[model samples]
Target: MGERTRLKRILRGLERRYGKIEPPPKRKGLPLIVATILSQNTTDLTAIRAYEALLERFPPARRSRPRRNLPRDSDGRIDKIKIRMVHVADARGEPNWRAIEKAPLSVVRNCLRVCGLAETKTRALRSLLKALRKETGGYSLERFLAGCDTDQALDKLSALPGIGVKTAAVTLAEGFGADLCPVDTHVHRVSGRLGVVSPSGGRNGTFRELRKILPPGTAHAFHHLFLSHGRAVCTARRPKCDSCPIRPDCERRGLEEV
Candidate 1:
């Protein structure tokens, strides 16, 4: 069969096996953004822990004036106040750059330390915030998103001191629900294993290859699906091939049988 046909078959199989792909929980601004930054070169659970620890140290609302039900967005989306506490408790919040930028570097670094690689991520985040402020006149998430197109936004973000293709893509895909794939280690590895791309190159190559095959508007969903499946089944070490729904269609490019 042709590559296109094979890819289609594999995607269909994945859909059948995984069912509907669920969008990751929409996080509040600061915590989720911080979590994404901490997620670099770290496990998700560790990132979550670091995120929680940071929030605990810098709770959104003090004990005296506990956060109450803030007004939701016009679309009925819950306001930041209501969800900020949940993010503090569990480290699952929206992407709030304003809150994160206002946080002290020491506090940010300490929070990130819980996940390991604290020093590196802390520097990166500091640089990112500084760059944002310099470029945008202020680090306003809504304003930034409104100012740039997809490519422009990605370029601007990647130009930041610590941000790279993956980080920039994450900001677009997760922060704005853009139709782009943030090819992290898991997505890169799993895509190669499933024969979506060659195994010889790195994540960027895999992203380029997949972009040619995937539909324009489907990249966001595709990224989430591949990521979720990679975590659940197509793990880096000893992927559960038997349990994988797409196994029958996976070419198993560079991977061994489970």
Candidate 2:
């Protein structure tokens, strides 16, 4: 069978093993922008925690206060008031995008310190918001990019601060349902070991090449499957190649033994 056919089989095995991989609900464009930024050089769980913390602190409040009907969590207490004021020292008003855009760099730095590289990420968020404001007259990306094609959106988003092919791909795929695939560290390594892409191709090149080879309408699921497979079976240090579901298809290119 051909490599593309083997890829399809691998994808099928991943689906059966892990079920369908869907972007979580409520993850629109703006939040995804921040989440993707926070996700760099960190565990997904840590990135998720940082993202929720960011949203919980900001809450997209139309005014200084969070929504009146905002529900309390398992901890109990509808503390939107407190959450809203958590960044009062740094934010001019509430912890919303407007506040972030106008807030002094130090305040924005404090707000994002939970995630690593607070200084860099804070500037990126502010810069991204500034760009959105220019594009849509305010904080709206999904609506602005609604009519844009995958390549167009990719090009635009990749131009943003701290954004590149991988980050843009995550945002475009989850937010706009774009068909482009993202290539991260695990995907790069696994792809090289499988002969799916050249070992020297690099993440950006792998992304370009993978897009041409992967089956249509499969990029989103394929990205997550590669991630899961990288974490579980084909780990970097000592891959469980013998038990890997796609071992038959993998070329084991650089593998010392299996």
Candidate 3:
């Protein structure tokens, strides 16, 4: 079978094994960006706790709501939505990035201590928000979502401090639902073992290869399901290959001894 066809079959098998996977609820750009940064070098549970801590540390500034909800159309006519007007920071529960930017680095780092790599991640987050403000005149990546194509978006995000292709790809996939696959440790391992992509160039290389052939509309589910499969079965050490759902498709690269 062609590579793409084989990948589709594998994806289907994964779906069957895990039951249909879905992306997390969409997060606003800045919060998602911060959360992705926290997710590095940690489990999702830990990352979530650290995210919550960060929010609690730098809670949103209270803003009075409009006296009445704005009608969708006072005249009962729908109007075209303007992408520029979408400021994700204005969303309820979003932390005050400006507050974060002005706070001491140690304070922010303490909030992320639970997730590990607190100093590094804290530095990255502060730098990223500051850079966003300078570059976009605000603290949101919504412009990338509204304006850039997948590749362009990836380039822009990857250039940010404390962000690599993995984090950038994730922000795009999870936050904006862009059609790009990110190669985290699980994804890199599973894809290589499944013979979907050669593992020569590490995560970024695997990500590039996967982008070329991952079936369209499958990026989000592919990422989550692959992550689940890797963690549960195709783990870094002593993977449960014998009963793995996609065993038929696996090349078992680097697993001969196991």
TM-score, each model? 0.76, 0.81, 0.82
Segments in model 3 whose C-alpha atoms lie over 4 Å from true places: 23-26, 62-93, 144-146, 253-257
Ranking by TM-score: 3, 2, 1
lDDT of 1 by residue, 4-49 (tens): 6776666677677656654545533323344567777766657667
lDDT assessment of candidate 1: 0.66
Give residue 105's lDDT in candidate 1 (0 to 100). 81
| Candidate models: Cα lDDT each | 0.66, 0.70, 0.75
lDDT (tens digit, per residue) of candidate 2 on 1-258: 487898898889878875787653333577566667776776654554565555566656554532233334467853331221112212222237786688688876775677678888877888898998988997888866767898988888888888778888877776677776788887887777888888697899899999989988888788877876777677888888877777777888337354
Output the number of the lDDT-best candidate.
Answer: 3
Query: Which should have the higher lDDT, number 1 or number 3?
Result: 3
Give me candidate 3's TM-score against the actual structure.
0.82
lDDT of 2 at 209: 90
Candidate 2 lDDT: 0.70
Candidate 1 stretches with Cα past 4 Å from truth are: 22-32, 61-104, 253-255
lDDT of 3 by residue, 21-119 (tens): 665456577776787788788776567668768778887788434232212335553211110111122232467789899999889888999999998
Error of 2 at 124 (Å): 0.7
